[model samples]
Target: MAISPQELSLHKLPPQNIDAEQAIIGGILIENDAIDKIVGILDQNGEDFYRDAHRKIYKAMLSLSNQNEPIDLVTLSSTLRSGGVLESVGGSSYLAALVESTPTAANIIYYANLVREKSLLRRLINSSTEVVTRCYAGGEKIENLLDDAEKIIFEVAQDKTKRSVYHIKDLIKHTFEAIEELSTREGHLTGVTTGFNRLDDLTSGLQPSDLIVIAGRPSMGKTALALNIAQNSAEAGFPVAIFSLEMSKEQLAQRLLASRAKVDLHRIRSGKLKNEDWPKLTTALGILYESPIFIDDTAAQSILEIKAKARRLTKQHNIKLIIVDYLQLVKGRHDADNREQEISDISRSLKAMAKEFNVPVIALAQLSRMPERRE
Candidate 1:
């Protein structure tokens, strides 16, 4: 007899742990508290189970737990029935057999770990296979292909292959702890300080994950203001990252030195430093060199590139504040037809990047006048 496709698929099953799944289900049906134990250990959802029946049964168990109802065989079966899946989950007979076959609920955690391990392995294999297939196709850009492959492997290795839902109690506990810690700070600057006492007082310093937009007309000192804030934050011991799309790093350094030494910007640019001005410039340079301020003058950078660089800076230098000089110059990930839409996407990506790194991002923007009004 020739083997059918279904039979062939059955022969080549993905990594799984049916015995572990059964133990997990049996523990949940046997004891109401076992669900809590399994949830805590697995931190997973119904889809983590290998068997279809186990998945449905686990979903019912989660529903009961969420509803603050019991998780015994009867309540679970009732929930499954209400959801019109009791028969599909092998009825109550399979559930009963699961409970009888498993010796005890004490080892539910070990069994849950086994199931999670198998699930992770399966995800890795699938991701790797997809990456291999794409590599063989040879049509996409090499850079894009590498990025996709790295992202896939990183997701699996970082345990970010799936979205995680945190319990409310845990979130509340973290909030309370943060509140307590903030209360004990000396200057009452709960977040990273911007070094401006008045501004710090008004905003409680630069709060983490905040997107601060500074908009102004041309020659309005927007870059100057951003650079000042970056310097302040760095001096205050918070590492700062500056993405200068409008200025070169040398120009930025010159401006910083002139600003710190209270010298003329024009004189600094012209290299007309007096003999006495050398000491002041040297002092400013020494302080700035020691401070944790990083500058990247990548012109016309896309949002994705900015995010990638920011992530690297965060991991390498633990940057707490980011300053994008003149955000209007930054490019979007895609070339959209509408200019406003492109700018909107860029702004959204910057905000999202701030949250992802838990840093304060101060993006300077230009106030738009009509294009025809330009000199």
Candidate 2:
């Protein structure tokens, strides 16, 4: 294969620090206690290592630790030997060299961090390479390509984030602080207010990560209730996102206007405004225009589409609540075996979205008439 000098120069060494990798392993080999710190920093495994040999050695150490066995020269060598990769890893002599090369286990955290940083850069490079390749593929949709590009970059970026682990001491302090703050408020709720006194009191004002289902029969104002809640939440200074699969945005706005102004819904819909209703309508319209309530009326939306939009809203607008007009109207996988199964998938997805965004989700549902029929 012929290659240009420029191409060869461009392919310069990928981000890596062999010394750091060896130091981490050596530190862990000398002091097994250090592995605990490195384990959490690395990918919880040996995948963070650039060299195959180092990866394999770290993996063997993890295996020994899992079995409650000590990680020493003898156990590690035996474990590698038993796995038939002892010779491939430069034999037992190379393992000894790693331990001798490292100064002490005290700097294991710093060494591990160095290796982790290099690993992230390498991943970013690989992701960029893939994105470039996909961009030239020519047979894919632009949206798909862009999505793939963003996804690869996002994965590399997201890898650097550590899982949150809140200590009980901190949690208890936070809880006490919250209780004290709440006590000082005359009627303020801990969670976002839904405007209705009884419901707000009963549910603690639509708690975060909750999937609140409002169910009823046909023409029972399920959507009307959701829009009202959205209005209330927006009025309370909380951003609201409503996905009305069954109605248009204009229809939702009309309903909200009528409800807020204490005017007749039918009269507004019929465009028959009485002389006195015009003042109330204009006032309601002005207030509604300023609320941080966003509505999406794209009907027959799949769960994935809804999630993508909701994620965008949460990021761009800091949306606090998500309302799906009705659960049964949501589109799910076409390969689903039955309608019941499809609805089940949508239900679970909505719940997951709520938890993922740490926001409340209100999905309107319809009740079955079998009980009313006395079957």
Best by TM-score: 2
In model 2, pairs of residues that clash are none
lDDT of 1: 0.75
Local distance difference test scores for all models: 0.75, 0.78
| Model 2 lDDT on a 0 to 1 scale | 0.78
lDDT of 1 by residue, 1-375 (tens): 997443554579888999999988888777776775556335334667778788878877766654457888788888889989999888889889999998889988889878888888878777877777788778999999899889988877766333222111232232222111111223678887866789888989889999999998888899988888877777677888888888877678778778877888898778887888877766666566656778877676666557666776788889999888878898763447788888987898789888878999999999866664965
Which portions of model 2 show Cα errors greater than 4 Å?
1-187
Per residue, candidate 2 scores C-alpha lDDT tens digits across 29-137 of 8898677565656753577889989988988987776445899999999999999999998888999999999879999889888999999998877777766767766
- Give the best candidate by lDDT: 2
Clashing pairs in 1: none
Sliding window of 10 residues with minimal summed lDDT for model 1:
175-184
